[model samples]
Target: MALYRGTGSGRLSRGLLLLLWVTLGSKLCPTGAIVQGANTSLAVPQNWTAHESATPDNKSQLPQFTLDDHYWLFAHFCWINFTIWMNNVTGAQLCDWRIISRPYSYLQYCLESAAEKLKFGYPNRIADDYIFKSHYIYFLNCTQDHPVLLDPPEDMLLALIIAPICLIPFLVTLVVCKSKDGKTQS
Candidate 1:
């Protein structure tokens, strides 16, 4: 009876630990950063409707860009490109076009320029600044006055990677704890 009780407790503890691992792992996973690029059928936001209406040809209006939004956009691009390079997706093409390619062109120069103009990192401990406006190209130097633009927060990528790693130790600890309980019961 005592052995059975110990085994049951061990199993319960292991199950609980697994649950905790999954919960923590999920919290760390990249949730919002992933985007489906081919989904042009997505509903346009209301703010975009005003710009669309103003541009009769649909070519004159600049695409509205936000720093956080662009960061995720670039992150998605990087993810897609990495996947393509790994041959996970079929018909993925890697090309080098100057400043007008689909994703790269939109992010590389234009956004940086706008950030500089807006003084995104000026007069502050601006660790980094990234701009993603559609039609501007800018770059700001890293200084006490100028904010850094290239580096993003640790959470941006670390959470996506580290959270999973952290789970491994957590799982191992739980398993060891459970197994010890089982052996002691026998």
Candidate 2:
């Protein structure tokens, strides 16, 4: 869901720049200018009917979701992420990333931590939640000069679909960057 409008030379340059902007923008900003992290304690409404509504803090043990619920949870997760991305239109209406990054990050953090049971560990959900948030900022910064085409998946494939799509872009970017470096040296 990380698509952006870029300003560069050709279509390839603009695409390469935007591809980088959406993919690496989260990692590039240590201050997290793009998206803020979520507060896992309790930022979302506790309604069971809504998107993964349940606190991880129980009296006896840590929060845990039923395995049967995972499929449904995953479905909702994908749906909500898609909804947010769809609303994330880019260009002239784009907002400043510095000003409006944290809330999205927070929402993302809350969602992943609650749904995926991740409190403190590797950032496996970075691509899932963080990237979406990054794309949000990128979209907000869009202009007439930089129109964008964002393709977000809308199916039950969830991680199966997401993992491969994310990797393809990274691999392509890697090869492109290496080739650019090689040409520069020549």
Give the top-scoring candidate (TM-score): 2
Question: What TM-score does candidate 1 get on C-alpha atoms?
Answer: 0.21
Error of 2 at 112 (Å): 4.1
lDDT per residue as tens, model 1, 82-118: 2222232222232223322544443344344434655
Lowest summed-lDDT stretch of 10 residues in model 2? 39-48
Please report, in order, the local distance difference test score of every candidate based on alpha carbons: 0.37, 0.42
Model 1 ranges off by over 4 Å: 1-50, 56-63, 88-186
lDDT of candidate 2 over 95-126, digit per residue (tens):
65554465355545555565555333334443
What is the Cα-based lDDT of residue 107 in candidate 2?
46
For all predicted structures, in order, the TM-scores are 0.21, 0.25
Residue 76 accuracy (lDDT) in model 1: 35
